[model samples]
Target chain A: MSDLPENLKYAKTHEWAKLESDNVVRVGITEFAQAELGDLVFIELPKVGRVVKADEQCAVVESVKTASDLFSPVSGEIVSVNEELSDAPEQVNDDAYDAWLFCVKADNPAELDTLLDASAYGQLIAE
Target chain B: MASYSTVSLPTVTTIHKTALYELHIELGAKMVPFADYQMPLQYSKGIIHEHLHCRNQASLFDISHMGQCSLKGSSAAIGLEKLTPAIISRLGSGRQQYTVLTNSDGGIIDDIVVTRLGQELTIVVNAACKEKDFKHLRKQLSNDCQLQELSEHALLALQGPSSSHVLQQVAPEACRLQFMQACRTEIDDIPCMISRSGYTGEDGFEISLPNRFAEKMARILLNFPEVEPAGLGARDTLRLEAGLSLYGHELDEKTTPIEAGLSWLIKNTHQSYPGAGTLLNQMQNGTEIQRVGLLVEAKMPVRENAPVFDNEDKLVGRVTSGSFSPSLGRPIALALIDTEAAVIGATLFTRVRNNLIKLTVCDLPFVPHRYHRS
Candidate 1:
């Protein structure tokens, strides 16, 4: 079973969003997503302050075998991104929840209601 | 599931199913379609871990889909030697050699592993090109000889530093065989053919057994603490690190063994063999492009089909195979380039998407070979 925390919301694409005070929701891929990708070698994330729509591709993670896109769960303006991942993307595989991709100031916080909670996400992936 | 903005997702094709499909799924492996089989590309342990396991310990691989056969007759040696450049007649009993099935014009048809087993010769060819290879061999050899395809057999490769030790527990005599030698042995009262050869450049064995006994043999081997089941993804990367060539990438119909840097397999004494004239001529006047190894300076890997450029940014060739070599902890590749451009330490550039990654021509077998020759 994947280590999905109860504090965050998840997208069906396997990304997690954690609310970080006020309207900011920090985003990152789930552990299951990184494990499926194997060893990550390169990552291309969107620039800071870039406005991204919900379900839009916000980043790209490439492993030795294949490349995958990271989608945003809610419409938001990017505030901060993990610059350390530029050199060591394997950290995402090590701790997906901790290796947050970017912090976005969500345009609509109510969009979180549509996302699955930790228990619901667990039930969804269990199938 | 919450609805999201729609985007064109990459088409996920139907994965081709393999004979051991259920077994892989049970092991929690990541299955992918490769060549026509729904093979296990990696297990839950991942490719790098599986690759390192095969180097340090033993790893079992399902290679049953590869073609295997036996050629028998009084004129089998002479008849087969006419098609390949290897000196098969001179190979001693229980000896194995790597040979190329060649075209009349000296191009490579396929690379095969040929083993001499007294009155008959056992051969293993690539899975994808077996049909074409069998048809060509049938046409080239005389009717006095017989060719029997053993498609019903399951082939498994047990490779690593500890392979011999693990195999000795079952077949004690197998521990005595030297590299490139083969013998018929009984493992736990089951009949099988064991060859002291493998693609990973480790001390290992390729065991051929009846289909009915394959699952059992696999279970028996996996019982050993040192052995684990690896998938095709690790197999490919391990072979690449060992400087071994794959059929579609390095060995192909348009390339010759000489051009591929496998000229040593062409014996000097085989003067009357097929393509000997063309090979000897190429030997006298070296080939235009020679296969060479590359060491990428950056962490980003240069995958297959990436264009290679010279110092002046002139396109010289393309990468045939490339990967992040687990053993070396860096990116390595094999490329066939113009002879003048293949010099060691020559600065080259590999076009990786929009960025031009710098590379250097380095020696192959990025990891030192650990085969047990004694």
Candidate 2:
């Protein structure tokens, strides 16, 4: 099983989010998801300052095999994007969590309740 | 059988496993349904490592799913030439050549490698097209010739710079063979008809033996530290970097040899094959669409069937195959474009999502081939 830190929250789509501040959240795909995606070649992130709804397709991640739409985990405005991924997209495969796609400022803080804890997400992929 | 391409092929409930299926599981391979067969997409070493390993050292690939068969008879060589555009009758025994089977309308039936070994000819076709390819050959051939499919055989390719060095540890005769040569040989007393050819554009040999000894041969080859197991993922990237076309991606029934950039295949001075009427006509007057290579400066990879356009946004062609070239550290693709725009160094556009990226028309063999010739 891939490492899933207990403090982080995960979406059923294999994205994990960590709350960096009171309302600010860091979002990226889970380690298990990156391994399944093989070597990531390119990434298209949502623009900074763009407002995105939870579960909305806001970005795209392309591997040699296929391209996948990256879904936003929370309804929020994007504050930052990983610009280096345009040339070094393999960072996600090297370290998924550290290579967050875009940071989001959550609209309603309690929306984190809708996400799964590390244990729950672990069980989801195990099935 | 189906394709390894996830971008293509429909979802299915059942899949056939190869003889080395258990061994792949033991190596911690990620299995996926390819050509309706459960196949290893990547091993524990990952696609990049396996790909580089094959280029620098040696890699063993279980390609048993490809269709292997024989055409036998006094007229096997002469009669077989009538169905395809290759000069099979003149191909000579002990040699193989890359050729295509064409339909009556001048479209390709399948791209295959035919090896003429004395009285018989051995053919290896794509697994996805084997069923229909066999049915078509049987229906078109005369009674004097016999078409036999090797249902109980397994194929493996040991490839790279050190392939012959590692293979010499088992079969010394492999070292004497040149590229595109085939001979009846043995490893550990198990009979195998090994060919000095491969799809990865490497100096390699494809070994075919009975199904019962499949794992035995794989184990023998893997005993060498230089020979590691590579999977279909690495196979795809390697072939793509080599600029070799995959069956379903770079070709299909609707595409012709001339349009697919395979005019060299029809240059044997004999066009007396099926589809000769239209194939010859197209050969005389150039094909409207020409298959060419593309180098993308952008980070995003242009995918198959993506609409290609001129700088003015006028539709000109479509991408046939695309990928991030591990060997070159950039994105490259094979596209079919209007003959007018197929000139080398011409600029083209491919739409990815909502973005139109610039592409330069380039010559093929993204990486140079290293085949060992006589």
Candidate 3:
């Protein structure tokens, strides 16, 4: 909750979704998740044109000691991925929200409404 | 809106804590359950930072979980020779040799380091196999040899280039000892059995002292600017880069020393150890599979149990140990593969999830060993 942006919504799987427009949303892991994963060394992002369902596995983040699957916060089509991460995965460790994993075009705009706000997400992590 | 199954947390289990447990906690270490003991995985500085520091300077490791015991008798070395293929009789006093305990079928029971102190032989064994190793020793050795577990003692490893200098301030005589030598000395008035050897393939010393003085000694060593506390995570990476074989991975009950790339440990003339028949046979002929180093082509780590395949998709071997080397700045591994695939520079493949990653056979010791021989 220390750096959880007030405007963005969060998924229980530790992913954050920021609606850029009516249909497009930027997705990334939370700062809390990155801190738990230690220093990341590699990341495998989903294909740009791949169709994904809400809460489905879409990417992977690997730290020096372990690797974790990143689940999609909402159902959509992946329009773009962060190419910069392939060269410097540590960028995500530097700033989790800033290093967006991918941009998805949401199939249903109402799905964002179901995500947790900053206060709710803060409580979940605190527990 | 969608519910995803959360990663299940490991159940709370009571585990043994070392004498340095409180010190490790105070140092902001991330504790993990390992070998039935609560051991430090890393400190606040992280694994990569600690690993690099060990290579450039020096680091201290709490290895109290490892088992230490002594075989007391004039014939202790000869008695131990019956269990291992190493020529222990020739080992002079105040010297140590890395050897393995073999079963009747030539399979490795456990790898151990045996030190000769006058007429007694002291040994250090793996933490996971300590109890079993001692039981085996008790049953196998003759009545003349008495086995005593040094359970009250705690062990510490101070490794890297500056290790000798750091240790010299407290125990001066330990610095003069050559590699693989041991001596009973006092450090800051605390009695200890100091040895010039370590698992990191670096110039270091393994200090064994009573548990009561462990925290005091650790604090003293930590006061030195050249020494920092390292955890089991960095230890694994350092040993991996050093190309040292880890038990339960590169070695197991079904694997022999010859197949594990430890043929040098088997003395050519001595063939009377537990599994001498099959060991000498493999030594004269060859093993079916050999442990070899691999240079992983992909950025992703190829971890243990990953299947290795040849060009035709035929399964040839499996990865024993794999990780992203902090020093090489790339992924490296060790695989026990068929003799045909053990060729240096030969390309092999390992499946990671949905992709087949390419791997090349490379020479061991991704990093060179820096021992203080002089």
Candidate 4:
């Protein structure tokens, strides 16, 4: 089992969201998700200013084996995108927590409480 | 959420386990359902490492899921010639030839490797098409030929540049055999048949032995420092880089051998064979669409079924097989396209999602094959 960061909240879909400051939340895929997907060759990040709803498909991640859609955990407008992923997508595989995919200005900060905690997210992956 | 890929999923209820199933698990392999069998997609080291390890040193692959069988009779060679385009009778003893099983309509039923061993001929067919291939052979061949499935046998391939150096430790005589040659040998007092050929385009050996001894043999081979276990994931990338045609991807019931750029395998003689008329015609004239390799300029991979287009944005073909080439560190693919657009240096494009990626129609084999030929 992979380590779950206590400070971050996780979606059942495998994306992790961290409340940075104010209403802004940083998001990226969990470490367990990267292992399952294998070496990342390509990543399509959601553009800045793109308004995405919770549980809606916001980005795409592709490996050598297959491509997958990444869903947003919280409904918000995309404030910032990870442009570095365009050149080096393997960084996510190296450090999933450090390589955030996008930052969202959350519409409801209370949605973070609704997400799974560290222990809960660990249990979901264990099953 | 990640969508499940059907590529590695098992559709059937009855699943088969290979002889090295336990060994694979011991090595921390991530197993997936493939062709009704639980196969390792990669080991703990991952696909890229496994692939390069095979290229630089040596890697052991469990090919037990592939069907192994023998055709024995006085007219076995002649009987096999009727199904494939290769001149089976001309294949000398202790030698192997790559050929395809064709239907009457000039379409490929399965791609197989046939080894002539004295009076009997042994064939290795793809796992998914083995049952159907045996049925086809039983119905089409004459009564003189006898088909026997080697179900109790396990097939293992040791592939890489250092394969011979590693195998020479066990079977000395097996290393003396050149490429495409085969011989019955003994390793650790166990009877085994080894062929110096493989799908990875390396100097390797495919060892066939009884199922009871498979675990012991794999353990002995794995004990070597150069040999590490590779899985189906690395196997796919290696074969694609070698520019080999896969059964379902580059070939199928609807695709002919000639269109797949395998005209050299067909004998020049006008011998009677399945789909001989169309095959001979396509050989003499030309095929409308020819299979070629594509080098993707963009970083993203162009997957199978992606529509290919010409410079004018005209629909030309579809990508049959595409993957990230670990050797080249870029995306490579095989696409069947119009003969006019399928030149050595012609530019083509493929649509991936909303992006139209530029691709160049280059020669087959994004990476060179290092086969040890005498």
Q: Which sequence of candidate numbers ranks them by TM-score, best first?
A: 4, 2, 3, 1
- Among these predictions, the greatest DockQ belongs to 2
Candidate 4 wrong stretches, greater than 4 Å: B1-12
- For residue B300, give model 4's deviation from the true position in Å: 0.5
How do the candidates score on chain B by TM-score?
A: 0.94, 0.94, 0.95, 0.96
Q: Which portions of model 2 show Cα errors greater than 4 Å?
A: B1-14
Q: Model 1: residues >4 Å from true position, as ranges?
A: A1-14, A22-25, A46-58, A71-78, A104-127, B1-22, B271-274
Model 1, C-alpha of B236: deviation from truth (Å): 1.3
So what's the TM-score on candidate 4?
0.96
* Candidate with more favorable, higher DockQ: 2 or 4: 2
Write model 2 residue lDDT over B1-374, tens digit each, in one string: 54575675565546788889999999899998888889999998788888889999999999988998899988888877888888888888889989999887878889999999888999999989989999988887788889999979999999999999988888999788999999998899999999999989899999999999999999999999899999998899899888887788778788888888788788647777878888788888999998889999788888889888888889999998888888887889999889988889989998888987999999889899999986
Q: How would you encode candidate 4's per-residue C-alpha lDDT over B46-105 as one tens digit per residue?
A: 898999999899999999999999999998999999899998988999999999999888
Candidate 3 lDDT tens digits, B334-374: 98999987999999999987878999999988899988786
Cα lDDT, model 2, residue B266:
81
Best by TM-score: 4
lDDT, candidate 1, at A24 = 96
Worst 10 residues of 1 chain B by lDDT: B11-20
Extract clashing residue pairs from model 2: B2-B35
